[model samples]
Target chain A: MATKDILSPLPGTFYRKPSPDAAPYKNEGDVVKKGDVIGLIEVMKSFHEVQSDADGTIASFVAENEEPVMAGQPLITLNI
Target chain B: MTRKVNTLFIANRGEIAVRIIRAAKELRLKTVQAHSVADTESLAVKLADVAVNIGSPAASKSYLNVEAVVAAAVASGADAVHPGYGFLAENARFAEAVEAAGLIFVGPTPHQIRMMGDKVSALEAAIAAGVPTVPGSRGRVETPEDAAKVVELTGFPVMIKASAGGGGRGIRVANSRDEFDRLMPQASAEALAAFGDGGLYIEKFVASARHVEVQVLGDGYDVVHFFERECSLQRRRQKVWEEAPAAMLPEDVRARLCQSAVNLAKAVNYRGAGTIEYLYDETTRDFYFLEMNTRIQVEHPVTEMITGFDLVREMIRIAMGERLRMRQSDIVMRGHAIECRINAEDPAKGFMPAPGTIESLTIPGGAGVRFDTLLYQGYTVPPFYDSLLGKLIVWDENRDAALDRMQRALKELTIGGLKTTKPLHLALAADPDVRAARFDTQFLEAWLEHRAAMLEDH
Candidate 1:
């Protein structure tokens, strides 16, 4: 089976950390389980935690911190 | 508390802003309009006492920019802001920001807006207030496991909705466990895209239900319902045709329905005009609370016509902290009213948006007929905003008379240089089921498709 990249399900500003001073939830080369908190997407004062649906090692992070991401746009690549 | 709305700043564009400008003008209040670069030459800007350029065509830079709107209000020296329908109308933070700026947010309080903005929380409040809600999850599920748990408890064939979602986006139906599993990701993705909150909430889907809503006005203490409207005819969760006094409801049940709306509004200490929406199943004669819109709805005109009230003017009065001038007992339903949303869209071409300059325009005029529009000859319908060009409302003594008036008014309306859904609306008015009010929410879409197929057959 081919490894798939996790994409943003909505359009918003993506934040890697919960807060500016907090540690990132997941980093490069980190092993992640299904439903693991990947990052938060802020839309109109609401923060939504974007979760990973596949178990894998992080191949790459496609979105930058505080960057705007579109729906179905790749957020992070996962190596199964 | 005494409030003075000397100057009003409208924080939206298109026909709604124009409508607000007219109402403000009638009230002798100076109107200040903020427009994006695209809407600079629109009718609203032309009619306003003064105009300010905010940003580019992208809504984020103009309408959705709370700071920009507040800055415009401050710069224009306006004492109040009127968020016309969409954008920041129901946004609690925006309301708070407006209040923080020491400007009157001409709607409900931030607390009220926040309480009603969340669907799950709003349902809980409705239940607590003795408002009947549909059989579904009592609260929102945070995880897929939680959603599965709720599904197992409530059984299958449930709907997954976004807590922050509105306008029919971020909703998916699943009939089986496999379907639920497959649809969860897509729905979550959609919810995230639409509302920025992929927080999915599950509810039992009520099929073949009539979309009815009660219009209510409140003064932060007393609340009164102004009867109900049947908005069963819809396309993609947006109301297309609305009629006052639902045709199929029993008299006692209708009274109870309207009263329930009043109770909920009072429970929240809601101010200004709001709508209490419900899903009514005709077969079972059961109704359930759907949601409360804490702003003036597009279909307010129909209710106003039937009840002989100026809802917009009431909103302005309510915003000024004036007590509701009329009581529930004083209100009397006089006539049947119907409104058809006239949009710049071609129904024959999959309802494609047809935006262009109006080469010719002739609006119908007569007693018992009203057209709330901003379109004029030589005016261009912009593609940036919603396709709705105007609303055609007609009132008569009875449903049949109202239907005849609407049909006649629609036939008389003329707008060239762009296609519209008028042809489709005319055809629907002629349908037997529609005339009898036997149609449900899905009637319009299916009927349009059926018409398309018949056209193909011909």
Candidate 2:
């Protein structure tokens, strides 16, 4: 019914994979459920999981891997 | 040749930006405020003559991003950069970048930063310059087994500290052998978590220690001291209250502390504003060098209020290659000054950072009362940066009078629709130990714990 974008809940470095050598939590164009973990935001040595809020087809990631991001900045756009 | 800096680019945020802008304007120099996208409406932007969007609100990508900051300075046509304290202040790469971009770095040289940045190297430098330092492990204790050797040498009641940590994080005090055995791994884990380095060092813990520091100014040749400031009142390793002309130090000890700071400054060929921190054991009356901060300190207002010198203005002038006019003897301390850091924190709730919009503000005033802040009505306090909203400094002819004035000032000041640590400061100013100027770095934490227990009983 609507297209929504996932925004980082805090300001920090956005990590695509769980670890440097691990596979990314979600890839572009992959369908993600509402509870799926999409990325991680690391701030002040603490990490917070950025989860998908809506179950939708993956549109594209706005923030690159290991990029610094601010709170409320777009991380991924989901096309429902 | 020393070049004239006509315009200064401040690569910082919050009240420090406002402080630097006012100082720059006083010298008739054009000021450029570097702001993140979040700080577009900050007071520094309003006060400065020009504003440049550096980057995002995240410090690592904005104020701390050397390339972005240097680019902003270049774009704004600034001839010099004052990093201010905290973000990128001690970063040698940022200083080198500013100088490489043909702009004056308002603090120390990159070499000086590197020499003093690392805790081990700074201790070595202090020893080399004949500045007495706390006895500890010569280098990092790589393993837990190595820690015991240091403990045997330093004895029990040892302090385990991270080599790359500051602002009080990465430190754990172990009192006995059992505690030391239990805490070494914990301390190393925290150090690795905080600074990405598990490198830990051990030092003999000073039980009755007073945090005293000497403020120094240098021109890469001559160095001058601004006496001392006592920052014994701290919370979780951060200073809560600061005062100049430290209370109750012997005259000879004061002379030695000042001279030791000067010795280290001259040894490093330090330039601009700097501070040499010392841990003074009250019982033994021995002072050991802590570390050298190669930037203008947050508590500089205390020294300025007492010595009547514009430290920020002098920093700008020195960056422009102008010689310091006043000799060490010419600078005099006439009055005692105390400063309370007005942070946007909820003291009752364990000093949690309470960031929100200020609906209104009523500041204290009159003679000897100085409120340095960027806060105003309708401004939102961003949660991204430091919790500091401003500094409340009061000055008087003596310590007793200064303390009394600070109590009155704390009462008169109010910020509507925001929870702050004003109530806690009011309590501190009234406390018996604080009134008597008797405190150590652990005083605030103990006081806070005591207050919580008292409230629980009620």
Give lDDT: candidate 2, residue B379: 96
Model 2 docking tier (incorrect/acceptable/medium/high): incorrect
lDDT of 1 by residue, B1-458 (tens): 86988999999887788888988889999999999887888889999999999986657778999888888888899998999798999999999999999999889999999989997689889998999888766666788888888888767678888888866677788989999999988888887887788887898777788999999999898998899999999987789899998989899889989999999999989999999999998877878999999999888988989898888888888888899999999888987999999888777767656667899999999999999987989997665567889999999999999899889998899988888878877877888998988899888888877785332100
- Please compute DockQ, using alpha carbons, for every candidate against the native two-chain complex: 0.03, 0.15
Question: What is the interface RMSD, in angstroms, for predicted model 2?
Answer: 4.5
CA RMSD (A), model 2:
5.3
Leading candidate by DockQ: 2
lDDT measured at residue B83 in model 2 versus the true structure, 0 to 100: 94
Name the candidate that leads on TM-score: 2
Question: In candidate 1, which residue pairs clash?
Answer: A10-B192, A10-B193
lDDT of 1 by residue, A2-78 (tens): 57889886555678999989999999989999999999876433467999999999988999887766668899999
What are the TM values for chain B, all candidates?
0.88, 0.89
lDDT per model, in order? 0.86, 0.88
